[model samples]
Target: MRARLRAPRGLVPSLPAFAWLCAFFLVPAGMVAVFSLGESAYFGTSPVDLSAPSLDRYGEAASETFRIVFVNTLQIAVVGTVLCVLLAVPMAYLITTRLTGFWKYAAIAAVVIPYWMPFLLRTYSWRILLGDHGPLAEGLGVTGGFGIVDTLSGAQLGVVYNYLPLAVLPIAVALDRLDPALRQAGRDLGASSWRVFWQVTLPAARPGIVGAALLVFIPLMGDYVTPAVLGGVQASVVGSLVSSSFLESQDWALGAAAAVLLILLVLAVLAAAALALALGRLVLRAVRPLDLAARLRPRTGTARPARVSGDAWGLLLRGYGVLMVLFLWAPILTILVYSFNDGRTLPVWGGASTRWYAAIPDNAVLMQSIGVSLRVAALSTLVAIVVGTLAGTALARAGRPIRWSLLGLLLVVFVTPEIVTSIGLLLMYVAAGPALSDGTLRLVIAHAVISTAIVAFVVQARLSSLDPRLSDAAADLGATPAGAFRRVILPLAAPAVLAAAVLASTASLDDVVASSMLGNVGTTTLPVYIYSTLRNGMRGDAAAASVLMMLGTALAVVVLAWVMQRRGQGKSFAAGLVGR
Candidate 1:
């Protein structure tokens, strides 16, 4: 206790995250819920009083247009998710159990580096690469085999391409924690290797797989970017439906209604998750003989004792890894190499130019947007760490009821779409009037609330993995709550906190739909800037800007990883892998 007191007062380490949630996350989301019930405004900061809380908006949810987009969103999300699972399982397997040393590091890096490229740029890159305007047609020796980029299929491919990493990471973590001995026992019991994987490893990793699936699918359901540019109207998803309601038709109420439906759908997904978890527990208890989860714990503390060597499947795995990496990064790479492109098309490799990169300075509006994004991400990261750490610690130490509520609230925020978040923030701002309606503060607050919940989820996941005895040991040694936390919990949980902060920052940085809707005139962020550039057909400069954001993410993450390591947090990086 005395040591903690002496450490630093700045690290009070006891911010009331619940209060933070009420003020930011809950209030804003509640405000949006109200708006979803009421009518939307015309141009100013007021909800239209044309109607007072009605089912009219929700009625719109049942419309045929709604049905089509909803079905489309589901179809795309399901297909994309399936592809992501197939691609990621092998990729994760290779990274965790097969690859060794530099190859391991390289594989991990490869999986992650594509994110440094601006998402818009990556989307655009796929456009050019797969388009008849690009090289895929010529290179693949197929006249129209490459035309897939212009259809709904292209959008699905892009969504899967972009979100593959998100899906892979969680699955890999689950795979990392699997007991190799369980599989060995299966082999000894005369089970085939494939049977062992299906009956043993797959079931063990289901929660993570389910979580990852939901994580990918929900946002992708509300995803605006890929479908907007790639699919046009041919394969438009619900995201496009929601977006067009606002920008194209200027129908905020309709958009808010759609956003509300999306939010409900997300909640339903969480409920389904809970039901599954409960059923699994019940199934576990039903028969001690049916305790499948119990049997899958890994005996090997270490993953992949050796690096993967050669064979067709190994090559196939490596090729898939490369293909996925290329699929994601080739756009950024094309842009990087082609931002120097004197011509819009590539592969001929002739006149190189940095004209676009040089022109970035001239794009004052775009540059300002970048500044806005950085500031938003930085503020969100700060708020997220404080709230996430506190909430996480509280969940670990608090009552079960409180823990479940906190988790439920966090899940609600996590599953909610950005458009819904934006609408919610707008309603809050409208209700609050000029106090919050017309400043960068509102955008920051909106981002912080949602991002913080995500960070808290990460923090809670990490904290739950801790041995409770560690905190108990500190307390038994006469450490006060704060002191014990500082000495024991904080150091151990620091890496998770840092990771949460980074992810929050990335969410903030990458967010365009929310920032654009909530931001004021001339309020710009990197994503908004990239979006504007893409909208303007400034593909080259857009690529340059995208590369910058991607580079920034890479630099920030690398530096964060390095700093965390310096604090002896290297091993604890694995702390939050298991959702327990």
Candidate 2:
């Protein structure tokens, strides 16, 4: 007798996503790896040589000039990551613990909603704010002596500003899951409030803190945009070096080698972190007996409260939070105000007028770029939602090994630097001949590669929080697998999926490096347009373009919120979004 069996649902649905990734993401990456081995083509016009490859490019990449660039990049990324962690941890703790009700929700929304604005616009806004004639420089009477723009300090400021959300969200999630009873227990046992925090709280949040650090550190190491826009040539990092190698020098091999080296450096950092954790676990095991004894004898029956009163601390923290909010928005506010300035110069705000905004409609190039950006964003978001949701579902339901493999691939995409991927995608497009020279399809493919990972991560987070028993119950009732998914699981996952789609769209819209490298004439997106305007000394026009870009992406975020609210998951989704 033949046995009756039902095929698995998730893996089957997951095939399309897997294939898409292999074709678009993995192929481009593999091509780059292959390119790293070959000799440089003359002006990058001749066909690539596929002969026996050597480590010639690697040796060149390790030259003294490049070594200094690597060290500088490391120092900046480390400093920026440390600053972000210090700022984010305390702020996230305060929001989770001290704030309540409406204030708590409002606080998170304030931090999150600003991020919906394209990062390119935010960086551009910073450029104007920190320029020699800009507010900060003039106000401090250091217009020429010392300022952020075109300097390493300025680049670090941009890094911290851009990646702050990444550091905060993970730590916030960890804090949300933290049990208040643990802290209370420490206090009742005669430990000071600081001691309770040091012993009971920070350790519990270590994983999230580490994750946040990785998130900030990885991107900072490979960042080209912040340095390009704010730091200028003097503050060039490894990312700028890679771009110069490929585009300016037209040395494909050297650029590929530099990209590979950057990836290795990131991997090294991850390995060091893993080793440190292992060593920490061993040390903890060795000191376990001493720790237990110390705990047993520590009771003084004289528990001291925190140094500052709770109300005073809350007030201070709340004030600091407001200041941070202002700091984050200051550049954006500057851009918005200056967009309507009735003058040619950017830094000197002329009398308020809407001439710049009016000029936008008349600029054919600007309008065309806007149209291209919208279509690309829309198409990329659609692809990301479908592929990412399927991949996320498969990972959630698949066997342990399969799940882990999928997770590794997703993380690889997440942590890989944008410049590296941008160059890689550029090379792949170049290799595809005249048929693939058009930028639109290549741009969408490049964006979908990264955006899909983001969507999958969001969906996976939602799925992890759900109970498998709900699906099992449906199966127990004789409902078909597809029927159960459509009737039960889909409703639950819809809010997160929609939110992910919005995020994906925003990411696609905000992209700079990938689109810039892959794009040719007549294919410019808004970010590419803004970059060109800046390069060509059209700051006023860039500001106007930026405002429009911000409005579009911000609208998507508003829609995301509405979707969550309509699905009756508003509060829960907000918590998840804030990394609770």
Candidate 3:
């Protein structure tokens, strides 16, 4: 008898994610690349015409104006990333080493709270705070306020605040994972506290630092919200340029070319970072022996006075931690307080009242947008969880080639600027014509594509830590592969799966880039609605809506934390939230 054909071990399970990404991500991105080579059709039904393709758009993308915008974008990203690292390192170090029990989790929750809130809302809060008559201005005693609003300084501050949590969480996880014995060993060998931290602790946390940098820089490069809301015309970056090229100018070819350049810039930065890291490693290896000898040598002289006592140092760290917490929550609290404003506009306070909260029910358009956001988030999250779980589980058990290949693809998906993804999906939908006309469906697909990589990473990290024998044991008991997976693997991975679900949902709900590009009048997500409102001028009702969204997100975060704690996985929850 002929032997029945058999599928590869991990291929079947990984197919769902692979197929979805190829169709939604790869195909759309390819379309964008094709559009970049074509010319814009000014009066044609389509924005681009590929009848005679050339490299003209790319040359235009490299012109003087674009060069200035690109330089500004890089400067903001580099500076913001450095600030995030500077702030996050000490805070994360203190949290891991000093805080305990309730305070530790509370501190972490503080960071996660702002991160969980909608991105557009967070940026818009800064807009309110920096307004001429806003609280910061009033408190600083600047008559018409410090001229931060609609300027580069305002944009830079927003960038640092918005991406700070992304930098903190990963570093915190890395510092938390460090072995305390390594630091103790250094101290016992005549090394000072500072030396121990520099030689032992910091080097060990390199992965986290690198992770945080990538997390901050990649998205910051694509962030138009902060620049648009805070910087306005003077600080237009490459991201805003790409956005306007399509949305306002109707120049799809130029937009696509600019997006391609943006991606190249990101990749070049990453490549340079990798090279620097490699060179640093080589230098470290060369000097490692001398460093070891110095550490091993006995001290001949009397020790100098301690620079600061342990108590003083601890107090300083605690004080810094308090400041960090305040910085994270300031914008959110501002929104909550101003949501009760009796005034028509958000910037000026006109006494405390609940009219905006009361008016929420009467605001039909806002309510409809809220409903759309909820529906799209729910549906996209469901799809992401299913596809990501299957893909992640298979990845944990797959062969080396398949695992690496898929991981690389997922990393690209994760690191690709959101604006690029939005443009690609928009272009794809436009190419598909009327067949994909449902706005909500487009939003769901776009959101799912973004969230799936995150879910898959989280799930894979969770599953990789489990023993391989669990499923094997189940199989030995005469269970089928499917039965073994359901009975043993699924239950074991539940916490991670649940955590991934929460992340995926929150990401979808908080999304602005894809929602704005893919949504229409009837399908406007709450973030897109708030963005438009803020662009026109912030209203009290929008502030109220932001508060409600923040509370909803906080509730979800609390529930997830409680459930994970019940499972004795509390320590890993934050890392899981960030897919570390």
lDDT of 1 by residue, 248-297 (tens): 77666777778778777767766786898899879866764555444443
Which rank order by lDDT, best down to worst?
A: 3, 2, 1
- Clashes in model 2: which pairs? 173-579
Give the alpha carbon lDDT tens digit for every residue of 451-561 in model 3. 998889898988898898888899899997789878988887887888899889988999988998888779998888888887678777867887888797788778878
Q: Estimate, for each residue in 1-580, the C-alpha lDDT of model 2 and write its tens digit.
A: 9999755546665677778877777788888888888888674465356586888888999898689788878888989999999998887887787888888877777777677776877787786777766777778886463556787887888888998878877887788788888777776666666666776688777888998998899889888788777777767788888887876888788888889999999889789878999999799777754462355335566664437665787788888888878977887788888888887776676789888887888889889998889888888889898889878877777667667777887888888998888887887777788878877888888888888888887877787778988888999999977788778877888777877877788788888888888888888998888877676444676678778778766775668677778878886566545433
Each candidate's lDDT (Cα)?
0.71, 0.79, 0.87
Index of the highest-TM-score prediction: 3
Candidate 3 Cα errors over 4 Å, as ranges: 1-5, 290-306, 567-575, 578-580
Per-residue lDDT, model 1, residue 290, is: 59
What number of clashing residue pairs does each candidate have, in the order they appear? 7, 1, 0
Which model, 1 or 2, shows the larger lDDT? 2
lDDT for position 180 in model 2: 89
At residue 146, candidate 2 shows an lDDT of: 53
lDDT for model 2, on a 0 to 1 scale?
A: 0.79
Candidate 1 ranges with C-alpha deviation above 4 Å: 1-15, 39-45, 50-52, 141-145, 268-319, 344-350, 476-478, 574-580
